[model samples]
Target: MSDPRTPRPTRNEAPQWQSEDGSLILAKCEDCGEPHYYPRVICPFCSSDNLSWITCSGRGRIYSVSVFRRAEPPYALAYVTLDEGIKMMTNIVDCDLDAIRIDDPVAVVFKDRNGIPTPMFAPVQG
Candidate 1:
């Protein structure tokens, strides 16, 4: 049986939605200098079509987190503050829940989810 969590391979084309692997590409408005995620045809901030995708550093720190004890298989969810000053909600992986803490440094790790690369974070090794 095929694993249900396998990510589909991307074809030789640009993705309609942003890649899930923490590629860290976002649209910045050329007009108002605002950064937006979930790539759009127009800037939500100033309604400008003058936008460009830019890659960002994937390093971030845990802004807040919660351990799920009684919900849907129980996993750690967190708000990670990216180096670009954007706070993104994501799952913390590749580490023990006991090791997760607020302000702990994390680096991006791409995980395949049903054939789509998803952005996750792990503890920054020293």
Candidate 2:
């Protein structure tokens, strides 16, 4: 387990995938062709030690959402399934909670979260 004082490493923390623009990165299993949300040294599905990182297309569909009405900005949390087949927990911003719907197309956007470049999603434009 990681210490609570230590911050979780983001995609930018790795030497290779330095997503300066806060793009989403997923771990791909070289052995099983499975993709996972968090960076890992081994493929969880196949138990293979070989894994590679790939930048997501920044496109996805909203699987579900939960809105927090008490938040200052009325935070809406979402489970988004990237086109790469990996699902991630992220925030839906720049729109009203009522505007979000299941399977809605979204694009990744970078936002500063407590000094970290966190990824958020917004409705895709035509």
Q: Which predicted model would earn the best TM-score?
A: 2
Tens digits of per-residue lDDT for model 1, 8-112: 433311352346555656567899998765566788789998987777788899999998879666788999998888787888988888889999999888776
Q: After superposition, how far is residue 46 of candidate 1 from its true place, in Å?
A: 1.8
In candidate 1, stretches whose alpha carbon ends up further than 4 angstroms from where it belongs are: 1-22, 71-73
Task: Judge candidate 1 against the unseen true structure and give its global Cα lDDT, from 0 to 1.
Answer: 0.75
Please state the error at residue 30 of candidate 2 in Å: 1.4
- Model 2, 1-126: lDDT tens digits are 543432356443352234686677777888898878666676779899788777779899999999999966588899999888778888899997888898999998877654556678998855
Whole-model alpha-carbon lDDT for candidate 2: 0.77
TM-score of each model, in listed order: 0.75, 0.82
User: RMSD, each candidate, Å?
Assistant: 4.4, 4.1
Question: Which residue pairs show collisions in model 1?
Answer: 5-114, 6-114, 6-115, 7-114, 7-115, 7-116, 8-115
Q: Give all candidates' CA lDDT scores.
A: 0.75, 0.77
In candidate 1 the C-alpha lDDT for residue 4 amounts to 59
